[model samples]
Target: MRSYLSVWRLPSAPVLLVAGFAGRLPSAMVPLALLLMVQQRTGSYAVAGLAAATYGLAMAGMAPVLGRLADRRTPRPVLLAQAAGYPLLLALLVAAVLGGAPTAVVLAASAAAGAATPLVSGVVRALWSRVDPEVRGTAFALDATATELVFVAGPTLVAALTVLAGPAWALGVSGVLAVAGALGVATSAAMRRWVPVPDGPRTSPFATVLTPGLPRVLLSGAALMLGFGALEVAVPAFAEAAGAPGASGLLLALWALGSVAGGLWFGARVVSVSLPRQYRWLLLGVTIGLAPLTAASSPWVLGALLFLGGTAIAPTLTVQNSLVGSIAPAHATTEAFTWLSTMATGASAVGAALGGALIEGPAGVTGSLLLAVAGAAVAVLVTLVPGRRPTRGRAPEPVAA
Candidate 1:
């Protein structure tokens, strides 16, 4: 195996880890905060889903642009700009909610915020690749596990602040954390120790999106994310419909709990599996896992099933990241990764709205949850296509070795 662990031995690893954690804090905070904010202010679960969807859509639409800028321009400046602007945007959003500005306005702002998303995943992943190749997998695994942990805490943190101070305070705190995180990373010497790698022609990012294998990965990831968006919407609706809406948090926590477990399990395995095969199996498993949710009846049942069904979440994500690295050219890795994030974010936004609508209508929460299953299925289906599942890159050494 190549020396992926070399980055850890580098003098700069400590700073990178700190910065990565700081940057990741916002990932967990944003969705939960947005959902809680809209839920509280509008008192409509569907509207809350819409807000969360809007935020995701923005991240999808804008990630590539920001990432492209990072590749061609300076990552530090991009990071700095996002660090400064994101907080202001959140403040505006908070004000709009407080002033009871119409839902349309809130949605628009949410979309803008989403679009202006800083491409955090792209940035961080790019940072890791600069580490020695032998350690990249371990580094990726470690980061993915940490991110799963963030999801576990991010929502809880937002919920607590909302209960204690108000959702407004939660939003404010996330913005502050994001700004601080971005600035901290951008300023760190380790953050600037980036190695430039591009996978495509020096063309517009639009051209980059058109790259062959890249789009398939993006679409597959998008489909999986769409399923996630549906679950995000359905859990809240399901809880409310069951006469225990407040238990939605517990349900989601259970889901994240499963993810944390899965991430831990995957992290411990030193596998040499092919990235595409890993993806195919992971997607299939995730879809199969979600099948049980279509029959969920109560909060307790939903929580239990969600936790069980969530077992594949982190593994699928880990494989997806590995595939992205395998396929993209060295120079454009960041941009490519950003494109995946963008696509997923967009798909998630739309999926959430679709799920919300389904729950609000006759299909109800049961049908809405089926959307998650469908999402997993789509990812599996994509892989089943001829020539869609080949391992890219130099083909990662057997992940099982």
Candidate 2:
């Protein structure tokens, strides 16, 4: 607790934490907001789904490019550009949706809005890496926990605003938060003065984002997210099937609560093991926790198991961030983190789609849980593959700044 408090005492950590939360709030809000806006205007869930998918695809495709821009120059200009453009683009989307514009036009505006979103995740994680090493693990833990909170809060906010004002207003609020958060971060002393340093002679500019050990890290992250998505869908399906559909939200909340507790406890501890070893163990823990869910016949039992499984969430993410710090070239840290986000997002989408199908198939929710376990197993396999390990006995390249 004192260690986390010490982190907040740093000059800009509190501000950055708030900015990160507000900036990322849209990540949880935007797709739903887009879906609501499109559905209200068009009265077609199909079109709304298409529009939302386009928005996600746009964001996923552009994140790496935007991260590269932030890396090559500075996050200031990148954030400034995004801050100025995103709200306008979102406003355009709102107008297009409300004004009965063509579906194509509305879709284009949504894509533009997605592309204009600030690179908050990459910038924030990269910033943490630049801070004190002693607290970096805790920082990552806090970040992961806060992100889970955002997932919980953002949807509630959107639902309330949508019911009160309308989906357009809800979307506008997302734009407002994004603009405010991006400006706060962009103008901060940490962002204004920070620079990425070169990784010396052997590092190629084009190859920076693809550092040797990073691909496996990214793959494992994707696999983990895949498992998460499956669990998400399975919980809802299981709850609805058990005739307690309303319990699904509470179950997911409990899951997040467990993750929060795990993050706090894990962050407060001192570690002696290597990050890779810790990650593998955490992966095993997550998988072991998930195994019991298959036997759960009631929502209450499933909820308890979900909470147990969720306990591994933040610890795994903390280790993953540490691994990225060690593996990514200094100059392209932001891009590398962005790639992680992109892979996870894409994989989660795939997992959700697959899980939805599997839950309706012959095996039902059990199959979905099995698939989630499979994803964790794949993550563990990726880590254990001998070829994935980086070479030892070589000194790490120094930052040139």
Candidate 3:
């Protein structure tokens, strides 16, 4: 609670939150806006889906590598470089689309956007972790809640903008927002001044992951996100297949809104429970929360069920992030945080593709949503059961890459 409290009380919190808002808004636009763009442009969902997949894979694959690079050196330079690079790539994407470019061209443009995405979430998490030990878990909760806030506000804006001016306006608006967010982040006193420990040479993010406690945290996060990410894609396609073509956006919105409410509710509190126990319970709750989604038959009913099922999101994410900071070596904290970020992104991409493929022939969205539940359940089972022996030690540091 103190960490959460101290964060806003910090002199820099105001400016940093603004930058966070700017950086996060694009996530919504990319999934929904790009889907609309590619679907409309090539007159095929398959091409659009592939294009989006390329973007996901590119971002997930490269982000950890970029974060590892940032950790050894100053984060400011990385932030500034991305500020310059991302906008230009986005501009190229807009141009390619308006010019009626081929699928490869559009796909390439999306990949460039992915490659250029700044590690805003990772940066923010690292900063929050350094704030105060008493408040670290709450801080993580606040951070996770903030992410949900982005989806809430960002998608609502995209929906309104896309409806009024089409996906082009949404894309253009996101590019401008990204620039504003990047500049805000790059120039922040905390960001400019923040540096990894080591005061020494840099190490690989993979090496950071190899650290005992970190690998476990990263693995847990990956397991949770894999399900959530896949559900995002499966929801829209499932809605269309379920005889409710117009319900996709609303259903997705309900899911995000549920997370928004749950995240805020969870973050605003302070608890003394051990981090591992917190994580275990959160995963168990997710397993229970999501169990009913497989049986939903209507969009309205599904929306209500999703809202209830979202209760696990904030708790699970907050605990995962808190553990990352709690267990990280001082010198490699930022890199360690970035690895967790990368895990979620990777899981999401894998989930989306897996969910999409599962829903293809006879499985449908019902089965796809069932897969989501199963993924979360698997995470819960892995943590509590033996034989998956954790490699961490009481006082061991992460293996240096």
Candidate 4:
């Protein structure tokens, strides 16, 4: 509590937190809203799924490029430009979808819209790194928890809007939120004064990727999210199999609730371990927590296990954020954080695909759960790979390109 209060006391923290949440709402809302809208218009889940996937892939593919631009140019111009462009692109997408456009046109519009999605998540995270070092961990923890809440809240809001006025209305609201949130952050005092760290002799295009200890952190984070992606699928399937399909949402929400609780608790404490060691142990905790799910024969049992397992999720993310901030070159911090988002997005897609296939096989939901555990275990192993220790308390000096 004291730690969180310390974070909240920072001058720009409230504006950043609120605006960041609003700006990131679209990330949660758009995919489900777009899927429902396209499916309603096209009357095919297959087409809708493809469009949604295309949108996500486009966003993931373009985010690092935009982040790098922000790293060089500062986030104000980048966010301001995106704040204007994203809503317009989203409007175009909605128009194309509702105006009875062809499938190709709709898909292209979805891709364009996603490519223009605001860079709020990365920018906000990078800004957290600029906060005083003593409370940076708590700030990251709060950010991670807020991100989880966004996914939960975004879907609920979309469902409400969809029920009231249909998916297009839901999507339009998402665009509004994106624009307002991005503009708010872009015009903030902190963002207005932000300047990129001056480039060093070794600051090349690949400096972020080549930073010692960063590759392992990124790889482990991806593997952890891979587990999460599978769990997302497996938990719902578990509910459906138990003859309580409607309980799926409740189960997943409980899982997120547990994560929020864990994050708040972890953030308030003082950690005694190095970030790398803490990262490994947290990954291990995820793996151990997941291993018992194979034995869950009922939704009640599965939900309980999921709630317990989810406790590790945000703490792990907090450590990952801290490690990235500490090890990445100051010149490329935004890009480094964006790469984390990219890896998580891409790996989660793969995990979801793999889980979908495994769920249909003889192994069924059990196989998916095992895959989830295996993914986390692999992450633990990745952290043990011999590498330079991540420097704490400050950004590392740039390595040779």
Cα lDDT listed for each candidate: 0.74, 0.84, 0.74, 0.87
For model 3, the superposed segments whose C-alpha errors exceed 4 Å read 1-6, 199-205, 385-401
Cα RMSD (angstroms) for every candidate in the order listed: 4.3, 2.8, 4.0, 3.2
Give the per-residue lDDT digits (tens) of candidate 1, residues 133-212: 56666667666766777777887888789889987888777877777667766776655555444344556537665555
Clashes of each: 27, 0, 4, 0
Worst 10 residues of 4 by lDDT: 392-401
Listed in order, each prediction's TM-score against the native is 0.85, 0.94, 0.89, 0.95
Tens digits of lDDT, candidate 4, 83-149: 8898889999999988989999989999999899889999888888877778888999999999988
Ranking of models by TM-score: 4, 2, 3, 1
**Best by the lDDT measure:** 4
Give the runs in model 2 whose Cα sits over 4 Å from its true position. Answer: 199-206, 388-401
Model 1: weakest 10-residue lDDT segment is 392-401
Lowest-scoring 10 consecutive residues by lDDT in candidate 2? 392-401
Q: lDDT (0-100) at residue 335 of candidate 2?
A: 83
Query: Model 1: how far is 32 from its true place, Å?
Result: 4.4
